[model samples]
Target: MKSGMPAPDGIQPARRATIREVADAAGVSRSTASRALTGRGYVAPPVRDRVREIARGLGYVPDATARHLRQQASQSIGVLVSDLSNPFYAGLAAGISQQARKRQYTMMLADDGGSPEVEVEAAEAFVALRVAGVIVTPVSAEVSTYLARQQIPVVEVDRQFSVGVCDAVVVDNENAARRVIHQLLDLGHRRIALVIDEMHWTTGRDRLAGYRGAFAAAGVPLDDSLVVTAGWDVDAARIEAHKLLSRAEPPTAIFAANNVLAEAVWRAAAELNMPIPERLSLVSFDDVSWMSLVRPGVTAVAQDPVALGEAAISQLFERIQSPHAPVRTVLLSATVAARGSTAPPPA
Candidate 1:
């Protein structure tokens, strides 16, 4: 076949054109052709134009895999979250995607459905892909340790496990929880119940600590019966809430540690025909859309989950750029958005 012409019938189709073919057609060295095409190094304008024209004519496509290998970095990042169905995680993923697009990086997302085993599997897959870095809402320390051992840059978001071993971006869960619980305490809520999901992760652990701290500051002995570990789902929380409300000495106020638990508390109150604040006071550690739209808006710690995602991406890029730098933990602040849900205990 003639140079730059389609293969003749009965002959096997020719392989895709490479830089060598472009260089040959342009009568230039491979390095010069590369410099011209990538606009990286020095090449005369006439030579660059000739090389580009030849590349176009020859259908030469640059190999991104080879280029990434040469640069020792991929153009993609991995993002792992506990649940994408939750608006909180969805917002976080959006923030990460926005920042990644701005930086000319692609994101590979993995949802582990709140399972620690699944989380570890996702981390292993990311490592196998040789992603530039990872941002994860970790379920277990094993995933973080595995990534760190592989010399991968990792940034823990929302929840952290590898403290002092990796970068982290999280809100001040304990302080925010303490502040909101203190608001309820100041309103004369003595028998307040704390509804929580998982206590193994920092998100739940810190919030629980803050709850205890608030009661301690007031010199009130904690009643173990008032603390409810309602699994991770709204249904589980609802059942636990029913049990709490059925008790003869039921709590007059409820502090839900997350949006899901908050929703369960609200539903349980509704089913029991309990009037909020008048019959039972309610507060939540995380706010959601329905919280504000409801008749009596829930009192909650309003955290910027989107901002948290952005911050996690920023930290991951920093870690990728400076792998040997000292590990850093960024703690953001959440504010209480008090509405009509919380009030003094009923007489």
Candidate 2:
């Protein structure tokens, strides 16, 4: 073995410098060295500075796991998001970071990738880490139970529930849907079809309810045949759109539950050679940066995902500070943008 190189695993000599070595070298107690390295407890400013300087000079890196154990806690929050690629969640992540930094906290991020079991696993992992709290966009009701069992304070973002387990910070999904549908109606689109995600999700269900309320107010019969529940993916929505357009009496306009599904509707229209607002009109639930880049520009309901994220972080901290505080359900409103996607239905 080379003299300066690290020895092979399991055959290495056992003379590696320990925490005691660092403390002795720094002329400080072991606890003081630990606190200085991890930036944990209160110590004299001069002693902390001196210990940290010496530890850095000695190329010391403390084991984070060991530090966590010794402290009996971690100064980090766990975040579980379903789809990391979704722009809405990405915006939310940015907001979480903004507020967490303000509170001197860090996040342990977990992207479940839309798997229920993986969501549970992530929650378990967060529990094992002894996080200060959790902010989760739950993929299933099952995750709620798991989080409840862990007894961790949680702030559920972008969805609402009455499970009595955790606080929720969500958008006014029903009102957002209603606003979009009303926009289509004002543009003279009576034959509007609603494309939505699977009803299992709270947002999907609430948006569907909002769609129904809009139709009721507009005096349009709620046609079950015109409503389609696609999986939370563009391809699924595209297939559903194809099937809906294949019908003899196709809708003159479409209302997609979200931006991704809205994109699918756009693609389906192109595939069928249906011109926008000439043969069909469209409206969607969420707006992102790319909304205006599309052909006619997509009309949508825009919500502040970043604000929602910040609210969730704040709510979690509130829960941690006052565990018995009333569990509040916060609903942020959405803005309805009137883009060029909708017009009077063709005669």
Best by lDDT: 1
Q: Estimate each model's TM-score.
A: 0.90, 0.88
Q: What stretches of model 1 exceed 4 Å from their correct place?
A: 1-30, 50-61
| Model 2 poorest ten-residue lDDT run | 6-15
Instruction: Compose the digit string of candidate 1's lDDT tens values, residues 1-347.
Output: 56877556636535888899899889999999999999998999999999999999877889877888899779999999988988889989999999999999999999999898999899999998899999999888988899999988999999989899999999999999999888888999899999999787899899999999999998988897898999888898898998898899889999999889999999999999889989899999878899999979999999878899999999999998898999999999999998999888999
Worst 10 residues of 1 by lDDT: 5-14
Local error of candidate 1 at residue 15 (angstroms): 7.9
Give every collision pair in model 2. Answer: none
Question: For residues 296-336, could you state the per-residue lDDT of candidate 2 as single tens digits?
Answer: 88888988789889889988899999989888888789898
lDDT measured at residue 318 in model 2 versus the true structure, 0 to 100:
90
